[model samples]
Structures are given as structure tokens and as C-alpha cells.
Target: MADQDTDPRLRWLKPLVIGLSVVFVALIMALIVGLITGVPQRRAEAAKQTAKPVPANLSPAFAEQVLNLPRNSRVADVFASGERIIVRVRLADGTERLFALHSQTLQPIGQLTIQVEK
Candidate 1:
């Protein structure tokens, strides 16, 4: 008599447990897939932010400043990377000079002279 009373409850409990387990497994799989797909997208966004050049911080008067080079020097080539501009010059004495400047303000950052090793 008691066994017959509990039989209906057991019948409902088994299906309920199976349904809950399937839901739990589905949620876990979705979480794993989201993490796998989202990581590369986040890394690409971070790389784009870092690769962008920083804004120039200088007064308007600094913009008009001149970059002096040797007399008769001619610009051989120009290359730019990020916020820097590099000007390769052929000097009067047949040597090469590389001048690095800030791209936004055109302010001289530094210079490098290229000479053949003896």
C-alpha cells in the first residue's frame, strides 16, 4: 500500500532529474564555446588600440620650429611609423643621415648618421 503511494513521486523525479542534467550540460558547453570564440576577438581589439599612434601634445608655436640640416643636404627618402617620421638625407659630404621627427608637430626627436665601417 505504501509502495504504491511513492511510485507516482518516483516516476516524476526521474524525468525531472534527467531534464535538469541536460540543461546544466548545455549551459556548460555554451560557456566553453563563448570563451573560445571571444578570446581572439578581445586580443585583436587590444592590439588595434595599442598599434594606433598617440596624439601629439605640443603648443601651436612649437609647430613652426625648423629642423636644421647640413647645407646642400637633399632628402633621399621618407618613412613613417606610428607617431614618428624618419627622413633619410644625402648630405653635402656624400654621407647619409637619418632624422627622426614627431609626425604631428614635426619636432626633431633625434638623428643618426650612417657611415661605412672601415
Candidate 2:
């Protein structure tokens, strides 16, 4: 009968329409949230890019004195935070040390040592 044919079409059509509607609504919500949160993050990143870069405070001699490592120890890498400068060094005996200092004063704050197996 005509009614049976129409009923079967509607059975698949209804679920398809509902699934599409849910997907569309979820996409719109995600877009809205991204716009709301992304604006501030983008502005903060732009501000950081425009800000002046901090010069590294550690020299090999300075690091050696502050860290109390061997005289032949050398600086490997330096990392800076707003409040502290991190100096990573390789000692003459191949031990690695990390020293944190005050960014402004270059005063020692913390130290870490990592021993490498020969």
C-alpha cells in the first residue's frame, strides 16, 4: 500500500535528520567556544612576542663559581624564567649539573646533579 512505502522512507529519514542535526549543533558550539577562548590566548602570545627578550645571565666563569663545580666545568645550556635563570653545566668528570639563580641578581637559588654512567 502507499502508506507502507511512505512509512519505511520516514523510518530512515528521521534518524538521518536527527543525527545530522546533532552534528551540526556540536560543530557550532565548538566554534563558539574556540572563538571565546582563542581571542585572549592570541592576544597574550602577541604581547609576549612584542616584549623584549631577556639576555642570558650565565657565563662559564659565573656558572662555575655559583655552582661550586670543578674549575674546568663548562656551561652547556641556559634557561630563563621570569624569576630565575637555570644554568646547565657539564663538569670536567662528565657529571651534569643544573643551577637555578635569581634572574636579576644572578644569585644561586637551587641546584640539581645528574650522574652519567661511564
Number of the top candidate by lDDT? 1
What clash count does candidate 2 reach?
0
Question: How far off is residue 101 in model 2, in Å?
Answer: 0.2
lDDT of 1 at 103: 78
Which ten residues in a row are the worst by lDDT in model 1? 52-61
Compute the lDDT of residue 38 as modeled in candidate 1: 99
lDDT of each: 0.87, 0.82
For model 2, the run of ten residues with the poorest summed lDDT: 58-67
| lDDT (tens digit, per residue) of candidate 2 on 1-118 | 6557686647788678999999999999999999999999999999999886656764335444444666899999999988789999998888999999877567789899999676
State every prediction's TM-score relative to the real structure: 0.49, 0.42
Q: Residue 111 error for model 1, in Å?
A: 0.3
Error of 1 at 6 (Å): 53
